[model samples]
Target: MKGTNYPNRWLIALAGIVMQICLGTVYGWSVFTKPLMAAHNWSNSEVTLTFTIAIGCLAISSAAGGYILDTKGARIVATIGGILFGLGTLITGYGDQIGSLTVIYIGYGLVCGLGLGFGYITPIATLVKWFPDKRGLITGLAVMGFGLGSLMLTMLSPGMIASMGTAMTFYIFGGIFLVAVTGAAQLMVEPPVDYVPAGWMSPIGKKSSDGMTLGQAVGSKYFYLLWTMLFLNITAGIALISQASPMAQELMPSTMSVGEKAMQAGVILGLFAIVNGLGRLLWASVSDKIGRRTVFIILFSTQAVAFYFLAGTKDMMMFTIICSYIYACYGGGFSTMPAYAADIFGTKYVGRIYGWMLTAWGAAGIMGPMLFSRIRQASGNYSEALIITAVGLAIALVLPLLAVPSKAKSKDAKVA
Candidate 1:
């Protein structure tokens, strides 16, 4: 497979990168919020709801998309996702012009969100198959693009808004995303039979504790433990992300210009994207060496400390570092879980099983932001919300230690 004649492994990784770039643009939501609010004279809560709706749609669509990817292959699933996402954004731009927040929510939230869900899963299973030996690293690299995609957009969207206005910016991004993703989708193909890359040991042949099939994996104690961990991790991260701008205001109130504030927010979000992207690869690759369980323990435990510090820190430098570390943990969690799933369950049905697991993220998506936002609204401060998030992370640290890999036998177990 590494014959240097259009290396298929790299090609597949490239496709994963492209797919993630499109998905990451949505992660750049914070960059758009101020502009959207200033232009439409809408309240903060109303604008924030759009993100909530989009995240909910992403969660539902991801589950469905996983099932489809298992059956239909990457090309079809991604192509359709691109088309839907593009159309959704096009309509969202029109909705923006007319000041129809409802239309924007439905189009960008539901339609584009579905596209993100569908597109997000295709690369995971494909990359797993492509580099069975380096599953963690490959998976991390692919998903890291999703995190970095926002960095690219964060840099571009502001200039685009300045030059072309927000509505036209959407149209431009919608078209560019459609073309890039569609082209990348075309490059994706399933791995061939008995395909083990050069010098790579097959995971199937490894002797370890017995594992479960996808079905049994879902039924095991450890599966739920992993799910709980993910839920806590996501909840903490989303709580911070959803309230970042407002939190900045409270911490630095009356000292910064509007332009300075916007710049600060953009810098924070951009750093989150960069750190998050780096974390996906960094932690996942580390897992390959130290084992997934150790990494999870470190991630959750460190994040608990970070979140606590984030709530108390008033210094800009300290605040930025803490926020970046938190973002890294969030992104690392997303990348690590699939490989973790493979470690516990055999990879035969990983696509479908991982999809099912992502529902935890979906649940957290709803709970995290709402919890923090509502608490902030009620108390006029985020200190309590931060404390709650820190507690959740601490709890997550313990769940992984309790998880014992499933010992059930399955028909698929004999194939290796």
Candidate 2:
């Protein structure tokens, strides 16, 4: 936004993804569940709480970071986020050595969660500012690193845990997180206030492009509906994600050895992460062409059916496809919502506004894993849990119709 020393906006996006890759490691929590339990003798539910707490903290911290991003800019916020995340991981490793869940909770959940929140918001609104003509695609690229981060970790983490044990594994990764995030933070910057692409033209009557403050967005009925839609989408996906390794191993034929079963489950889980990243790119790109609302309808509707079929499938091939579909759609929500908001509310204030919207992800993080764990404990299987999610998705299919806003229908529809 200043002298033309470094005016390449795409470079800023690349930097954003580098930091996001480090932050996205949260989704790989399942990879740590067994190791944490075995190392510490914690119950399944107890180990699960770390993820829940982290996501809850992520949601709350992200909301605050968005405000800070709007006020202070991305570099300082992201640098601080890096410090906390790396420190949290280092502390979590120490917590493991001492067998202290409280320490792990404070470090990994509270401190790392803050890092995730701030880091998550750091790049989004900045990218939207730099690439107004490519909002969906740009945000998708910036966030896709997050999904890839999970995929990469899911593949490598088990080996790290097995070879180094959990404590040293945390120490090594913590150091990496610190270096990667802090260095990448240097590359992030807001565009000049009057910045626009060389030949980009604002779409005629693009309602969301009109500037609206946080107060204006919060007062609208559609905001609540959008929140509910995000909640339902995440709950269905994370329910399966929370217990995917265990559930997949169970669904594998009993003839396989325990090691074989675990390996196979890891492969499937890895694929879910891969497609999760790809889906963000693919679906968001499609939204640019077809409109966000229609693409979301297809995403939610397809996943609803996928969840139902997931309950009935015994074959690994079918299960893999269905779960990947669910994961892809689940990921689609993250990329779509930010662009959708900028489309309706204007890009100028979307950084903080989108941050406020992520609370649904926080709420769903708590709901999804707990729902999956509780239902499995009660029923001794994931079938009932799958059916419940299927039902939730079926209901979610109708919510998006109410969520989309047309500029011509009512100006300032929310305030009205």
Candidate 3:
């Protein structure tokens, strides 16, 4: 490590945040849902499927992208992801102009989803290696942009749609995304071998030690527990997210015009997006002081209570408070999980390990939105779906209690 002149690590972190902010706009899918539905005469379930497919593809792509990132490097993968995402968005706009739902799905759901996966994993995996000394805080900071990306798009999308129309808006955003994401990705690179921050010592007195491989990690009970916990948390949180705008509007008095309702819902959605981003930074940093498992426990317990209140709330103010809390905990799970996996499986293979763990995200993306949409369509309200998510969260609370940390070894990991 001597004589090495490292690029400023903080700049790498900045680049990662910028890329994530672009990728994170997928969370703003709900903002486009009603418009798309009205434009295409698609049902809620049909429109929601675009988001589901994008996320499903994101999980699959990220799983594969992790290996490429670990072996080939972060810059290439992120750049490719950026290109794919921007291209996909452009394609979606073109598909809209032609009125083809299938084309839109391919553009947004499949193409953009793949891009999201590749772009998303690059930062977390790369930053984990660069900042082992501040694993929790750094990973949190890296992903905080992703959480906030939704807010940026949410605030901008409505006005943009009103002024330019959805397709043109998508076209413009696509160009911006292409420029922004790839530009930032150019700044990303892996640290040198055996890199360490100046003045910091590894508590173990080694540059690096043996860590669990992807196979070894998958063999452990810890992996399964973490995966299931993530699944449950995402399932509950995303159910609301997929429908947040319309659901908020549903609670409004009938006297309000459609535009007014959309504006109010946009405001609430914007607030949720803000807390979602902040929660990542707040909870992940807190996990450094407490423990990762303890942080997850807190997230689960508090979110469970919030969901219980959310199931029946009709008052807009009360509804906002409850959803914001749930959003925080939901975002916390994401930021905390990377650190948690690093602690259990070791940072060496966390890219692969955590990438695979995101399959839970794919599954939840499909399950949460589909289930929420179906229940709403059938029952004419979100109450039943909200209650179901509450119960799921309550059950998930037990998984963290069972998740005890274990040491990573060069040999195959045990079921502990």
Measured by TM-score, the strongest candidate is: 3
Alpha carbon deviation, residue 212, candidate 2 (Å):
0.5
Instruction: Rank the candidate models, highest TM-score first.
Output: 3, 2, 1
Give one digit per residue, the lDDT tens place, for model 3 in 131-210: 87788899889888998999988998888887888899899999999999999999889886678888777655335333
lDDT of each residue in 1-416, candidate 1, tens digit only: 45534346887898888888787787787677788888999876777777777778877877787777778777888887788788888888888889999999988888888888778878887788777778789889998999998888777777777778889989988898888887788877766545667776554554322335567867777778888878888878877777776676556657787556766677677878899899999988887787777788898899989988877888877888898999898889888888777766755666677777777877877787788778877887788888888887887767767764443222222111
Q: Is candidate 1 or candidate 3 better by lDDT?
A: 3
Per-residue lDDT over 2-110 for candidate 2, one digit per residue giving the tens place of the 0 to 100 score: 3455468888889999988888888888887777777778987888888888888989988999999889998888998899999999999999999999999998889
The reply for model 1, stretches above 4 Å from the true place, is 1-7, 203-214, 249-256, 406-416
Judging by TM-score, tell me the better candidate of 1 and 2: 2
TM-score of each predicted structure versus truth: 0.92, 0.94, 0.96
User: What value does the lDDT take at residue 171 in candidate 3?
Assistant: 98
**Ten contiguous residues minimizing lDDT sum, candidate 1:** 407-416
lDDT of each: 0.78, 0.82, 0.87
Candidate 1 vs 3: which has more TM-score = 3
